[model samples]
Target: MPAVQETVDQVRRIDVDQYKYGFETKIESEKAPKGLSEDIVRFISSKKDEPAWMLEWRLEAYRRWLTMREPTWARVDYPKIDYQDYYYYSAPKRKPTLKSLDEVDPEILETYKKLGIPLREQEILAGVVREDGSTPSRVAVDAVFDSVSVATTFKEELKKAGVIFMPISEAIREHPDLVKKYLGSVVPVTDNFFATLNSAVFSDGSFVYVPPGVRCPMELSTYFRINERNTGQFERTLIIADKGSYVSYLEGCTAPMRDENQLHAAVVELIAHDDAEIKYSTVQNWYPGDAEGKGGIYNFVTKRGDCRGARSKISWTQVETGSAITWKYPSCILRGDNSRGEFYSIAISNGRQQVDSGTKMIHLGKNTTSRIISKGIAAGRSQNTYRGLVTAHRKASGARNFTNCDSLLVGDKCGAHTVPYLEAKNSSAVFEHEATTSKISEEMLFYCRQRGLSAEEATALVVNGFVRDVLQQLPMEFAVEAQKLISISLEGSVG
Candidate 1:
């Protein structure tokens, strides 16, 4: 029998839920009133102790949000979300002055430890050697528990390198000038409905600024966890790479399992100056409900990058494997002559999940270049869609772009779709787009089975090969984790 057929026959023999990051921690938390109003926005601003200008900004966004409506153009279906039924802010109760990790709640610390995040500097640097006997590269982490930053590692080291890596709230207080100048510069406050909402009630997120002519010493990361029930998580992150600077940033997210659906709306913006570069990566594994998809997270996010100066570059790589309903698009605006942009993504869906994600590349200057590569895998009763856009403005002479979209389906009940848009206003502009959708080949499955591999193993192997190109774009550590997540997400999906 074919390996795929065998896998289908055995799918009903085992019933297992493979989400290991669904455990919640017990901690006392402070929460705002359960509703959205002008007063609630003011309450959030007061909680952060932001300046008057910040408060006014929030109020303006809130007023604008009242006039906006939720978008429904995506290929995803979900029940209407009552904006007033969720807690806007929730944070662990702790002292205002925290000198070290010892002051953080022990239960929260254990939760992160269980999630494999290195919040301790010593543990990150403690005798961890690479295969070549050299110390492995370190990662600076900003841990955001529910609504506030619980801890940030390697502050001193990053400061010594002339890098500013801290929570955005701290940046608002310490480096107000930088924050004021760059905040909402890439993705405006009124960019979309979710972004406008985030601008009003965003709680906490990471902020990074790399000085000119300096390269960040190590990888910078932010880990977000949602633990509170009936609460929404909204974080806003901003990164700026000054002229001749370079930085690499990573983001990861997870949520506890619950019978009720939750909301996660986030905004991320990147700015690269002249001769600068920024590399952004994401590994999103939020809770995806159960086999029947009764409850899960509604992930709506907006992420964009701006190549603002000559010869600047920006790249985005993401591995998305969770979330019951996902609507996200990470884009880049090539506004500088000779600037470059790249997007590589791997999206996997299973067990009634719905994903509609891709990227946009806008060429606004002469000699600009952009590339997009997307791989989507659908299993069980899920639907995956890739929608992308590439456009060269009228003045963008000598612009070039290439896009490729591929999809793989594991079961007859699943679906994969691709929708791409391309436009070139200048005669000198060039563009190319290619897309394909297919299932695992029966001959390949039979060969793997003949080599003594089980049906499940063979399916995983084939899926891995299908996504290898996009996986190679991730960092070494993240690539390994993403590989394992793909296999786990496809388990019991063949039937």
Candidate 2:
């Protein structure tokens, strides 16, 4: 008899739902229908019960965005985006004031449970279970899916330090005064094309404030996921560190695989007052379409920070690996005497993905200093670029800036580019920028493979080494997870 064959069929594996906070809510959400118009903008404002001034501000931004043209200079090719085809507002079908977590709807809790983020850390630690068995690690969390902020954990602990960590929606109703003062303070509404769109029809995001002389004890976090396909995600985040305060905030994003490309435009602003320090970190893993480049998200964002007072410090660290099109530059302004700024980033694009990103540092205060370190990795047939700017204004006496950017191409099919712009008008300013690009060497791979590692393992090892500098910059609790995410996202088609 011929040898019998054992066969296995490809199990159309439903998405693994790696992140515990992966479930969608059920409600008649408050949404501005698909389209962009003055009516839609006004509708969003009215939905939020925003005052008249905000409505006028949004109108101005919309007008500015109309005058601005879509930027085509990036080394990216994708279908043109339609601004009108997206919902300007999508909120959880809940009252304006569900003041407490327990007041949340049961459906919302189910969404959190499905995503592995339980309502309270204590509940999670007690092992939240279902008819089937699964749970997320007992970490304090705030889950934001699509356009709504679902849940937040560790609220009392954060509140004790005079820190406000909540969804922008709640903050709008509870702390509108603060939101009105600081919203769009750093990255103005007319900043860029996507920013104006975000301003006009922005949905919900995290809002954080650290009052004067307080030191935040725990890390503040926001987890964002895109659930609805064919929808654009426009979120706005504003963080303010009051005088003599300190805080460390982190945000992560992910999206599902869909056939049609989705647009994600967001704005993040950070402000640090005298003797304050604000550190912001992001690990973005949006769906990067597929190997054949069928679909993915277009990520265009504006992130900037202002060190508004003397001796303040601000730092930004990001690991970007998803999206069919990614274009952003998180920036910093040293406006006060002896202020400091730093940026460390690692961006990877695979398959047909494209990313053009980096940071900008402006020095205006006496003896202000800044540093920029960036690593770009390109794989498959993707295109990746590192574009940055470092400037020292005329009044920036004794200013100093150092920028180092490096690129690694994993295959012959991909392309990498670097464009760093530096301008210095101060006589006392000193700056240096060094950039280089190289392909991952086969010898390095061979050595790792000889040590009994699989191809994927070997590749991950080398790429990890290449990005070690940037990885080391992440917060301790998040560094390991971020590195693992980078490894998995950077694998495949390394030839």
Candidate 3:
């Protein structure tokens, strides 16, 4: 039998690319000038040639952001970020128009291959081959390398389905009507500090729209890798599900190893009209720095969905396991009658990582319902908290919400906290909030070991069982991988 340290060492040798879309596309980059003044913001807006109203929105956000202070309420501590230290836009300088998969740079393709991210529906669809001629996925993918969208797979097929999946920068040019009507509609520029900053200097991100009565035949996924050092990735993703439509979209992000923390403040908004459904999932695996937590990524994000029409539904499922400091809350505004909102999350923090994540459910219409299930795992001096809010307005008659928050502590030195606020004005509204905190039982580990499992294996099994409820909510493609991450994050922990 191999020694524990030796087995661990073998696993340690595995490259970072194992995480799907975890790739490095090293290319000479073009970037906006450092320091974000009004002129810099104007430069970004002008560079993208955004409409007048959008430009005005950016300026307004910049002004409001100046008045906002760096909030220090989080349990984590880090040096203040110098806005001048970052390049607003850093993209591959090449003007290659990769309308299809083949036009993408060979280097970018190779990077995705290392990350195990299938490029197109053909590649991942049903036996598409890579450069080496080996097959991986048949799923469609839009690979965003740095601040540019390099290649999109099966785009023509999606277009035939009346679906639009392109970069936000390209969308403003190609689908201006959709962009004009919906951009910043759900989450405005003045929403929050991070959102305001993202509004001012957003570089590039995906834009997706599924037409009415269309059940997108293919899954769409975006792979975002920020390779530029000292660059702030301000991406805005907008997803619109028209009446009687449905789409499942997934996003993943990763940054290069850096001693100085990089900033990733992205804004994602979803609009589901009458009888439409949108399912959004994210797996964020940014570098979490060293064991001593010298420096990594500060992931402050604002994500929300608006159930605009009766019977609309929006669901957010996230598996967060990385980042030195993670501050994100994906919320839903249930404004339509009988509209449904759901948030299922699994946040894992290890080795000095701190995560303050959860969801918000705002019921503003009659008969609205929401469900929230959160799982937090903390270890190794890390802190994980689930902060959620469920509110029912005065006219939101018959509003209902069910919340179950569970926290699992792997080590004594770590911390896990749950703060939930429930506000209901409608006498007909019904809300239930429940939470529990517990640690793994040594007897369970002993029982697993007695059944012929190793220590690591036993711990992995136990942790999986603990997160089983939340893991079950993930899509099949993501569940197995998320389970492995949860297990690996708690390795060697006994407390």
Candidate 4:
């Protein structure tokens, strides 16, 4: 049998509810009082030893959150989340500072190891050599466990290249000026209910700044893990690329299985200056509850990027296959002349999951261009939606946009939806949108079966082909992992 088909068959044999990342890390943790009061916010801020201004910022966001209502416009149904019933902050009990990975808690390190994260720099770099005797590309990782960053590797190496890579909490302390200038500049604290809550109580996330005229020597990545029960994980990420610089960032997330839903509300901001470029990618695989959908994550996230200088570019690529309820949109603002933005997504839902995700492109400068391609796959009584918006402002003369959304259904009980909005305020602007919905053809399945493929394997093969376009956009290693995940997510849908 072909290797790919063999892998598919192996994955199909696993139980549908056996999420690979469902194991919890047993470690003593420190947590704030249960609830969403001003006092809880103060406690979190004080725990981080944040500046008074930062505290005031959180207070302002908390005040605003009190008046704001949770959005209900998305095509999803869920029980009301009781903010006061959950712990706002949770982190492993550890020393305030660590000099190396050896000092990190063994259980936490083992957790990341099980998740296939390379925290030891020397181990990852060793034995990694090409035929020409050149070292292969390396990835600097920021491992965030629950509410705090457990470790960030390759800090000294990144500093040599004038790239600022660290935890956001450290950035606020070390580079306050930069944080103050750009934090919330793209997605403000008052952007939405989830973002506002994140701004108020977010504990830790990755921060990156690349200097002018330099390309980052390696990929930067962050891995987030939620382990504590009944606790919400709120993280904030920010990246800035100065003039003539380039950086590629990757994000990965997971959570342990539980009987009650947990909350994950995160905010990410990206800024690119003149001639700079930023590529961001995500592989989200949080636990999506059992086959009956008894427990899972409510992932409400806001991510946006800004082209702040002429000729800048920002690209987003994501593979989402988890979460019981996912409400996210990664968008871009082309604010500089000749700027460009792109979004490529592959979303797969199974086992009663609900996903509503897409992107927005806003052109505000002359000659700005944007493109969006989204593919959604639904199976096992799931609901998947693709909602997007594209607009060209009055001043955006010569602006152009192209958008394509496609959905695939694997079973009669599943559903897929597409909702796109487009607007052009200038006569010189042009926009095009295309969408399609389809299901697996019986003839195709018959052909595969005749070729010695089982029903589940045939379905996986067809689904892989359906999402090949978006898969091509991901990094090489990520694409392979995503392909296997796609097969695993659809294991029981066909049989």
lDDT of 4 by residue, 190-243 (tens): 999999999999999999999999899989999999999999999999999999
Instruction: Give candidate 3's error at residue 152 in angstroms.
Output: 1.7
- Tens digit of per-residue lDDT, candidate 2, span 366-483: 9999999999998888889999988999999999999999999998999999998999999899999998999988898889889876566666677778888888888865676666
Roughly what TM-score does model 2 have, to 2 decimal places? 0.90
Residue 116 error, candidate 1, Å:
0.4
Which of the numbered candidates is closest to the native, going by highest lDDT?
Answer: 4
Q: What's the CA RMSD for each of the models? A: 3.7, 5.8, 3.6, 2.5
Better of 1 and 2 by lDDT: 1
Q: Model 2: residues >4 Å from true position, as ranges?
A: 1-30, 94-96, 99-119, 124-140
Q: Candidate 1, residues 1-495: lDDT per residue as tens digits?
A: 123333433333444566878888999999998999999999999899899989998899999999999999999999999999999999999986478999999999999989978887876668676465645448899999999999999999999999999999889989999999999999888999999999999999999999999999989999999999988999999999999999999999999999889999999999999999999999999998898998889999999999999999999999999999999999999999999999999999999899999999999989999999999999899999999999999999999998989999887899999989888999999999889999888888889999987767788789888988888888887777777777777877765
Clashes of 2: 4
Q: If ranked by lDDT, best first, what sequence of candidates would result?
A: 4, 1, 3, 2
Reference-based TM-score of each model: 0.95, 0.90, 0.92, 0.97
Candidate 3 C-alpha lDDT tens digits along 66-183: 9987777656677778988888877777654655566666777777767667775563656646576655654567778766778777787888999998888889888889988998
Number of backbone collisions per candidate, in order? 0, 4, 6, 0
lDDT, candidate 4, equals 0.92
User: Which residue pairs collide, candidate 1?
Assistant: none
Cα-based RMSD of candidate 1 = 3.7
